[model samples]
Target: MKIFNTPSNSSTFTGFILLGFPCPREGQILLFVLFTVVYLLTLTGNGSIICAVHWDQRLHIPMYILLANFSFLEIWYVTSTVPNMLANFLSDTKVISFSGCFLQFYFFFSLGSTECFSLAVMAFDRYLAICRPLHYPTIMTRRLCTNLVINCWVLGFSWFLIPVVIISQMSFCGPRIIDHFLCDPAPLLTLTCKKAPVIELIFSVLCPLPVFMLFLFIVGSYALVLRAVLTVPSAAGRRKAFSTCGSHLTVVSLFYGSVIVMYGSPPSKNEAGKQKIVTLFYSVVTPLLNPVIYSLRNKDMKKSLKKLWGT
Candidate 1:
């Protein structure tokens, strides 16, 4: 398949201007403050989770370790757009250079994709814990968890290499303006002079299919886990089972629901508002909520935090 349409004549794009939210000056300032607060919270929450997991030996289980990795990725994920977005909100113009744009997409997609696969791994972990309780330790061993984490990073990095290389070949001419706060794939592609049909097709195929499959796997795994929990004779046993899996499900619902909506559909100009809202849920809000979701609901995490802080 043709990676990118050949330019009628090769010309380097000077730069791309990002046409962000059409808000009044007051609205822009408000957005900056809102996002600034969110970014700070995201950093602190994820950073705290990472440090707690690292320093507390009692919290060194596979689940917390996975959470630590997710925390680190969340830091990078929010950083990719929030800083540039803050700058855009403060300035009159929001123009990003071609190299800068590509780099933004690289980090955004890389971290996002890793999180996608990481969620699946977490679901599988819960499945082993609840559905096959006796084999949880043997099956979800330390080596296996390490390998899964490594796979998430490697797969996320490799997934975008082809797409970025292909985008590099395409030429961007005049009207170098992008819609939205960041150099996202959909908004940026609309500005390209080259026929982006192949790029679109690649996105069309790569975007939704894996998410749908993973969604199905998560549903099936949880279904079995629920069945196992129901079989527990004692109320305490059932309560314990539910507590273990409840936070994971809550986070999965929040992150996956917003993410699937944003990337799972074809690009459209009209969906800009919807896109921004969903992006907020997945990118900014979810990270801030994750530690809270896990810590408040999980007894182990609460105990560990109490011990870690000597409270």
Candidate 2:
């Protein structure tokens, strides 16, 4: 892939343009309203879950702590994507400065990485709960949970730092148009004047490897969990066993499903629209799904929420 550039080396760009929300003028207004409603709900729903989890002493176990982390992550995760997207939808020109673009990419990738790692941690938490029931309390201590959350942020940032640094070095003197709503790595790579095959390859590897590892961990954890659940002997015990993990599995499926669709294959024009749909899936829809799945699916969460709301 030859990085095309018609200008001399002195040519530089002030900012990269984002041709985000490619709908008509009337459509932009509708999208702004729609996204605003969704954003507010995301904040409220995820925020309520966090508050409920914190206030209820009975819900302060490792599972709810992980659920709180998921809720907190969902708040930032949707915030990272929707605010910029909403602004672009409402703005006349969807232009972001180079520094601004880099900053956006950093937060977007950081939050995304945190979500991935948090899901993996949640899976491990479930695995220990189901497979090693007697030792679960001793194994997942409060200090351990704090360390895991800290490690998630660290891992998420570290994973994206290399690609962001590489992108920073590349010059974008040509066309400034970006196809997507935000300053994502793959689409922004299309604008660079330098041949970034190496960068592309690096990103290809970076993108899928962690996801694959997480997929394996989730699968392995759930498999063991299912096997353990089946051995419970009593029919009611099996239903009770599934209730504990059903919500987590639903969230895991929604997030990883969107991710696999968006990044698993090579990028194309046809795929771009679908990718955007899946992008909304992971960003907007999944965050919305988190509280719904957790609250409706988990009896404990529902009771905690009821008490918190004085219902």
Candidate 3:
């Protein structure tokens, strides 16, 4: 549990040393090369999706608009952590300023929260499109879609503000070394000088509410979509319906599955390595896979991508 070698008073601690995965020099170089490739691919993939959505008039529907926005969010979300992680890999000190740490903390969690809301919104869009096709065009207007996107961003950034501020103000008594790649709450909380049960309680309660609520809403929406799909008289109709949803469902499963394993459960000493792996999967791998999953399965997206490439 004690990862810090020098335990100092909170007043004397100026910044934190993020003790990212301890690896030999060769291993660090290997990892650096690997992650750099991953980061570039993440950008290229999500960026392509955004471009396809923007340029393709046929893709200017509610679903594609939401997807473009989600792709944009993914760009910043992975950027908030991966670049810094890459830097830490090269640097010997691996130190992050207090302000830098919290900024990463705020943006990373906020973007993640925004993604949760975005997925829920996408699911609701699907529900309307499938279960209530007649009302979908009338109900999911451009103005309404814009409002939903705005609300997702606003609510996501606001969700963790109070807790982050409170945590920032708390005293840190010892070695200010964070164990994970990012300034996650659990590791950061462990560094506090005095345990604030109230803050811990608040975090434990508030941390999962948005994720759980949004996840439940998505489940419900998809349930309705499934029912509707089953009622379709033609097999082709059923296949088309499932095709439209399959990518989102895959993404949802990958996202929520890793997240629930990471945040929904209590932290344990044995799970630290597992935690890092899961976090990397959701944060880095999932973004990388999203464009592939969407484009490969959706003919419209593939055509748009091809048009964007002038292929």
Candidate 4:
């Protein structure tokens, strides 16, 4: 099927071909099945966390509330790309319309940005809870907690807004094929007929530098947390503090490690396959593991999950 109406005509925008995994039909079927199972598991895992948090009255505190919100964000974050990729796996012509492609591009990045902000906030929560235990309650009041969550969503979505809009408006002449499953900044930038170095620079800064900064912020917060934990007189007290933070630290490591590598430097077109693998690890695998980490690491969350299952 023809992706663009004319191969050379830049103005004619029909759609773009999503060059998803170049596998045999049989491979496509297997991939579809595998990803379908993954999708279900991710949904089930994140959904279970949300339910467990809401169901257990004991988890009505600030930490759990933030967790429930993060779990909810995970649901949408995975939804932004995986479902379309699943559809592409079964499709003969994996053509996504311009609107659809950009929309996916927008949401996928927005959700990812939200995840970064959410992680930072979670790290801050841990810092306050551990480093300044006495003032945690006053600092993280219900109203302030709600406001922080709101700001994460707002700032995250807003982060890439101008860059995306400006890129979308640029001309794409021909070869309307994106190498990866999702519409990403690198491929989109390459496909644009008009060279916009300023946009590229902005995109470059927005993608990785902010993440690197957030990573530093989280690290600093944890450093303070570690100091406070060490100051705890009792071994049990130290264990309790570390245990409270261990799950979040693990998650932060998993997420930022891959993300920094993926967007650490500008992606070369040659690294298409590598990009897909990294994207899958962060976007698909992370959400699936979050419930396990939180529930198993957290005694209260585990009890809640057990009770939720029993009921």
Candidate 1 local lDDT, 1-311, one digit each (tens)? 53333355645544677767778999999999998998998898788788888988877889889888888888998998889888888888677766777888788877887888888888899889888879889998899999999998998878877777767667666567776777777766676676678778887677556567777888888999889899999999999888888998999899888877776677777787777778767877898898889889988777776776689
Q: Of the candidates shown, which would achieve the greatest lDDT relative to the real structure? A: 3
User: What TM-score goes with each of the models?
Assistant: 0.90, 0.94, 0.95, 0.94
Global fold similarity of model 4 (TM-score): 0.94
Estimate candidate 2's alpha-carbon lDDT, on a 0 to 1 scale: 0.84
User: Which regions of candidate 3 deviate over 4 angstroms?
Assistant: 1-12
- Over 4 Å off in model 1, which ranges? 1-12, 263-269, 306-311
For model 4, residues 18-106, the per-residue Cα lDDT tens digits are: 99899899999999999999999999989998999888888988899999999999999999999999999999999998888888988
Per-residue lDDT tens digits for candidate 2, residues 1-311, read: 42222345545556777777698989999999998998998898898899998998988888899889889988988887788888888788788877778888888888888888999999999889888989989999998988998898899878888778778777765678877777888777887776679878988788768887988889999999999999998999899889999999999998898898777767777765776777777888889878988999988899888888799
Considering lDDT, where higher is better, how would the candidates rank from best to worst?
A: 3, 4, 2, 1
RMSD of each: 3.1, 3.3, 3.6, 3.0
Per TM-score, what order, best first?
3, 4, 2, 1
Query: Is candidate 2 or 4 superior in lDDT?
Result: 4
Predictions in order: lDDT: 0.81, 0.84, 0.89, 0.89
Which pairs clash in the backbone of model 3? Answer: none
